[model samples]
Target: MSSRLARTSALTVAAVCGSALLVMTAVSASGNTAEEPRLHDIQGKTRISPFAGKQVTDVPGVVTAVRGFGKARGFWLQDPKPDDDPATSEGIFVFTGEKTPDVEAGDSIRISGEVAEFYPGGEEAGGQSVTQLTGAEWKAASKKKAKLPKAVGLGADRVPDAYAPEGKGDEGNIESLKLQPRKFALDLYESLEGMRAGLRNAPVTGPSTEFGELWVTADPGENPTPRGGTLYGAYDQHNGARMKVSSLLPREENHFPKADVGDELRGATTGPLDYDNFGGYTVRATAMGELKDNKLKRERTRKQSKDELSVATYNVENLSPESEPAKFERLSEALVKNLASPDIVALEEVQDDSGPQDDGTVAAGKTLKTLTDAIEKAGGPAYESRQIDPEDNADGGQPGGNIRVAFLYNPDRVDFTDRKGGDATTPVKVGDDGGKPKLSANPGRIEPQEEAWKESRKPLAGEFTFKGRQVFVVANHFSSKGGDQPMEGRFQPPVRESEKQRTAQAKLVNSFAKKVEAIDKDAAVIAAGDFNDFPFSPSLDAIREGGVLTSPMDELPADERYGYVFNGNSQVLDHAVTSPGVGPVKYDIVHINAEFHDQASDHDPSVVRMKP
Candidate 1:
């Protein structure tokens, strides 16, 4: 027998009730599921279906929604009569391959198909799986219209504060385990998968994207930041109220609202709860709410005091001279106005003059010159640039763009102590310069040859004299989270495969900071740039492991600690950590980008002020 037959044969039926409407069931069962094979029986109480990998006949439900567009087109089938159990959902997605199913809302139907778990990026990818029926064939059981089941209300009250349940072992796959919808948010969403769901007057936490999607908070009170965003404060807290919003309205209608952060989707937005690879559980809205704009504004950081040496970090998003003049102007204005033109600024993703032209050329002098010139044009200080260009395209970013971290400093405020012998392979070492500490090679790479730095931008260390005091600033752009599995992947807890290298990279940067302080205990060392990880992540923990460096954002209020926004959660990715010697530091994650529709760069710049 075939594998499918063998698995089906494993389930022994005690008896058949009738001939035409045959009811086949397992020998030992809790309820007569065969007699009434509703949507709940297929969904069960767990994430994985109880009848997964087996064939089922005459599963009954009402056509609640139909998805006519997209590669996987199908209609949602929801049972009008629900079971007493809240753990099992009454809805199921019947996958009809590429063709849109010939079905409509309020149609009572009976479907027969193979119950299978659809892992978005495959089971091996370690993402959560969606329980769906494939190769489905259905017939309209009722000629008359059937009432569509009420959409499950999703709000702060329903979705539990806990994010997800831990798996059986380290793998964290909660597929087979029973769901506790009242205790865990993931379980709650899983229980309502493919079911009609609605949120009333939802607050938009993430702005609408070009891809016709936005994110909203079911609970507006959950870890809300000052500027209309849900704060992701810790590892355990992923802001359970966050959910993606994708409109089901036809694209030709042009009815989707363009909303910014803090806006409210007024009235009721109802839709089927669907799962995808990008943002996990989403509300594919059949009835979208009207956009109520709050006219949210951007924030600016205060200027540094005369005695304070301000250092800032900004990822210019692969900036090159070839970029639009508007981009350069906007970035310069942001640096000078929003960020208050800090004394030292660490710029990440500064591409070479050729900007993604994959030739042998790797010089970025013209690129830095354009930015410095723009800053001056913007009525800011005449900032000078210092950066060691990587060898060709060794550092990863855009294909031809030799993106590297570069520093821009006002010569009048600080002096860059440029030492020789710094290159892509050469490591910067800490040395004693008289009574103070100094780098053997200024503007040097930190452990560039290490495997952790492979295909990643190396930390650019530079020595500067701020008011006759030796201060060190390290600019970094660690490995990106390209290979990491999605949070809603097949695995219960998504694996961060890219974090290992980042952790190692963080350790190297930490050791460098420690060495500077080791040579002179009171050395002012500021490590700032695109960390590409959260404050609570292992990489950031490793950076602060030995108490050598401390992130200043920790001092800020939990709600005001974020510098970047992703999906809908306003979180931290860029940071500026200082040594203990940099006393009485002031930091601000200047909100100019990330929250707005029109942005200079995807990331917002951060500034830190300290008396060296």
Candidate 2:
């Protein structure tokens, strides 16, 4: 039978379960997963804290069985419990696959799998969702003995090559003497057949490959629309070779391999994929395939989420429009060329309906129109930008262009079935003007200072749809720089009450989160923008308490924090706050290192990949 059939036959019925879903916060391994209590532990056990706060740790276990996905794989196992009752954890398993195996269960003759925590089509289920393995390994076989083949040198000069009996592939890397490919074949016996290679077929389940091998299938980009200046890389032949992409070949079905660690791969890559910048030169893969202890380590990335959305937020600091139609056109050119085209963009310091500012003319409507038009000019779809036009309260540096917020988005992401008005309403006036009879403070409101230098503050809100889901987005820009509230005599040091503005917005966000939650329990709400605070801050604390929202930024590492300064301290104010099973949005520092404020925005732009 073909390798595909062999694998299916083996996984007839699964017999393991565990903490079904975990709020995964790190990469996972399949085989020997166990470091601490892990959100994902394929075939392993741990007693660590079960909160989403465990920044990073490994769950230990042993090789049970490996399963395959299109381009990745997950392993299965029962996490060890306090009473060590294997029967109780039998129905659940941790996942670990793809070459990296550093995990193992009690020795040999063991197995594992992962449970679900939260995902689309999964509402009643909440807790642990096993999607990856952080640790795993194989143990000594308890059986009498296993078979061995003669003359095993796997491959090299005269070691011979593997050949598919059915005659597939150009056979560049497969050895001629090998019988066939076995999923996770490299880790099994050092050698197989006379050629020392296992059949490039399905894995063996109880000596029969009725179940599938831990190998994934990938669909290489058919059109080969390689980027203009990218460099890509991948590994091949059971960690024996590496392939740096010179150019993208047309994407074809079955062109790419789906797998976890240890499974033979075509190669690995990090981009500059198609761009000329990297040329055809060698490329490096930050991570590679290998078996660690016994676990199959794999990267954490769900290309598609339930909502099927990806978001990108930028501080596009000081993006102003030109008064001159001619200069305005040039400014538009810069936006198209530099500002990355993303599904959703939340901007700060953008010129709105107001006039010009000292830095640039980020006037609202026209500025947005120019940006969207520019994007379309450069082979992109048309878009709309929105913001709330409020009175300027600048501290004297030109009050005309002080409102700090704008968002550019793709309407296709929103489901019109549950559409809501995508406009800003809350009036957030700060400072002496007290802004319109004082915008009602959310749950926790703090007094704003008047006897000090302060910038205007406002909250931006928008609504959209994703994956049959309706969601709302609230963006904001609080007072920049520092200030103080004048006391009886001396000035009281400025407290980062910026959180108050955020908290107020947070209340608005909370109101919306509830509004959306009421529509669908799984309804997702995201409040994102530059918060100007670190991961753990009072301002953020207040917002969380007020909005009852979770933040995707919480999953990021401190060193990986966005928005940097010369002193080395990082301020993680930019965020994408979510509700329910919303996100751990894909974010990046988008490093544009420089000393000048204009080099890159004083604040970093954050990008989050939506479920889709």
Best by lDDT: 1
Q: After best superposition, candidate 1 residue 178: deviation in angstroms?
A: 1.0
The sequence of per-residue lDDT tens digits that candidate 2 reaches over residues 1-612 is: 123212221111121111111122222122233234422222222211122111224333333333332212344332222233221122222334234244332333342132221111121111112223223333443543222211112222322122112222431212122222232222111121001111111110000011111211121221111110011111011121111221122224432223322233333322111101111111111122221122222112223344457565666555555444543443333334433445567677675444454444343777678767766876555666656544344422245565567667766554322223322232322112121111222211112233221355455545566654445566656544333211100111213334554455445445545544554555556677766555565556656764467766556653344443311122356777777646445654443321111233455455566673
TM-score of each: 0.90, 0.40
Q: Please report how far candidate 1 places residue 411 from its true position, in Å.
A: 2.2
- lDDT of candidate 1? 0.83
Could you give candidate 1's per-residue lDDT for residues 218-260 as a string of tens digits? 9999989888888878766788889988876776655678888
lDDT of each: 0.83, 0.36
* Residue 518 in candidate 1, Cα distance off native in Å: 3.0
List of clashing residue pairs for candidate 1: 126-491, 127-489, 127-490, 127-491, 128-489, 128-490
